[model samples]
Target: MRDPAPRAVTSICRALAEQIERGLLTAGSQLPAERKLSEVFDTTRITLREALGQLESQGLIYREERRGWFVSPARVAYNPLVRTHFHAMVAEQGRVPATEVLSARLMPASADICELLQLPGLSSVYQIRRARRIDGRLVLYVEHYLNPAYFPGILAFDLTRSLTELYASEYDIRYGRVRFDMVPTALHNEAATALKVAVGGPALRIVRVNRDQHGRLIDCDMEFWRHDALHVSVEVPD
Candidate 1:
């Protein structure tokens, strides 16, 4: 025994998907009001929501807090092996990149941070929190933990600029021997609040441990990205 409601839901989902694919609903454009969509589809709000949820899971749509669903932009391609930093890579793709420093201060390293940075117990590190946007859409929330020994008076610089360039110019340090770890996760409260999404919404987490040209650990970054905002691509040579 099967309910007929799912058929309607599927129909609505397919119709809307086709419209999006045909560019009737442009990227970043909000969908019609639920009431209007329900009247147009002749379906209940529950079914409409189900279809929208399906679309969201497919990364074709996204919902903002207190705002209706909008068509998602095409994902940005990311190559972890590339040495280019965020600003450069985004500009190369013809997309605008913006970063806001949420907080920056000297903080005592936690146990995990100590282990990652190879710092002695009770050592202090410069902790910087940031929110990043692409084309005016909040896309990433990140925390940077930098070994304070390598950078003094770094807080005085424009924190919104590229830290990679800052490190080279200010500290004569170039990144070398970087490592990355990625996983799918639900956004935590802090990241969700910064990105303006639900606390438990799906996200992609990437952890990066970086070393300087002298082979000294310099920093580690934890990044939480909207699951719909990126496409990771790698090219390997034989």
Candidate 2:
């Protein structure tokens, strides 16, 4: 927009947001380049940019690394303690779910990991890194740390699938008590890089510690999710 008035800026932002809400723009669709959008909207680049910033802040759009802006996906309402796997939950929502196994290795447990799992002595822990996508969009990356003693020779198994299923079949393990600690944060380092967001983009960190029927820690899961990708809700029975 070359000489747009203030009203035009507000209108443009609102119009785009409505398009997103109505699925006219569709989730994960890239917006036209700045020059093209400016031309189409009959506005100056400055005005168009202002509207884009508004959309970004409202969680209606997001920018990717080396990529242009795209409409943000509808937030998934996550049941933090659900027994259902990610794939099932996603399918029930009419979205395709996929998981990529980044890496799996056994490493000497750090003091932090040991503390979180209540390990009394230094021991090795099996760590697996996974990135989960819904509708072909990368939304969450999680690192799972497990006590190697409970999973002897675990590296030989196919780890790309659900770990919960593996536990039930392999060791007859079932979840007992679980603890969750979550916080809003800015993505950084590998989490930001894997998620295709900037280093400082807003994100959420969910830490889950799961125990088995014997009251022994099964694993500690650290999950990093795109801020706009999930709307977390928990149902508690008092």
Candidate 3:
């Protein structure tokens, strides 16, 4: 059967979301001007703005005072409580997952990072920054810190794939526990650029620390999820 037409602004937002997921619109791509969009959708400007507002709330688009809207990048949803990788999560949702490795390097751990990983000062660590996509939409910017001693040659792996899976196969490093801290914050300049949002747009700042089977720290990761493109749900059993 054919799908039903979207009913309201919420439905319009979902249609735009589908466009992003299918690659009809790409990250950093500017959306049509509001008036033009209204004409294209055969709706009034008010309804168009309402749809756009919903997209803005979801972090899929951002507005400038006079410049108009643009597509925001995608992000990966990392749930520390679940023992699954980002790729697995996307796959389970029937979405295509891809990674763009922005940079990977070995650097001295920062004081705070060292403390989080329980490593000594001057210890080298692998810093990896990636832009994650789901079904071709930019959804997240991920920054991962790994203790160099534990995951040696980490920089040599194909980062377009899952780091957690690579660690499991190559080094027998399997995570047994994880902890998370989630906070709501406004996007900063760099984060705004990566997520294709205006400065001060809503974002979810997530901090995660993972540990191996022996309870040793494996990695510390920071992720920024555009508020518009993600929804968090909790299911409780009675």
Best by lDDT: 1
- Sort order, lDDT high to low: 1, 2, 3
Query: Per-prediction RMSD in angstroms?
Result: 1.9, 2.3, 7.3
Model 1, position 103, has a per-residue lDDT of 99
Q: For model 1, what is the alpha-carbon lDDT of residue 160?
A: 99
Off by over 4 Å in 3: 1-31, 35-55, 58-80, 236-238
Where model 1 places Cα greater than 4 Å from the true spot, the runs are: 1-3
**What are the per-residue Cα lDDT tens digits for candidate 1 across 129-219?**
9999999999999999999999999999999999999999988999999989999999999999999999999999999999999999999
Candidate 3 least-lDDT 10 residues: 1-10
| Number of backbone-clashing residue pairs for each candidate, in the order shown | 0, 4, 11
lDDT (10s digit) by residue, model 3, range 108-179? 889989899988878888999888877766667888999877888878889879988898899998887888
For residues 1-238, what per-residue lDDT tens digits would candidate 2 score against the true structure? 2445587689889888888888899988999898998888788888888898788877899888888899998888899768777888889888889999888999988898999998866778999999999888889999999998898887789887788888899888888899999999888788988888789878889999989999998799999988888888989989
lDDT of 2 at 234: 89
| TM-score: model 3 vs. ground truth | 0.73
Per-model C-alpha lDDT, please? Answer: 0.94, 0.87, 0.79
Per-prediction TM-score, please? 0.96, 0.89, 0.73
Model 1: which ten-residue window has the lowest total lDDT? 1-10
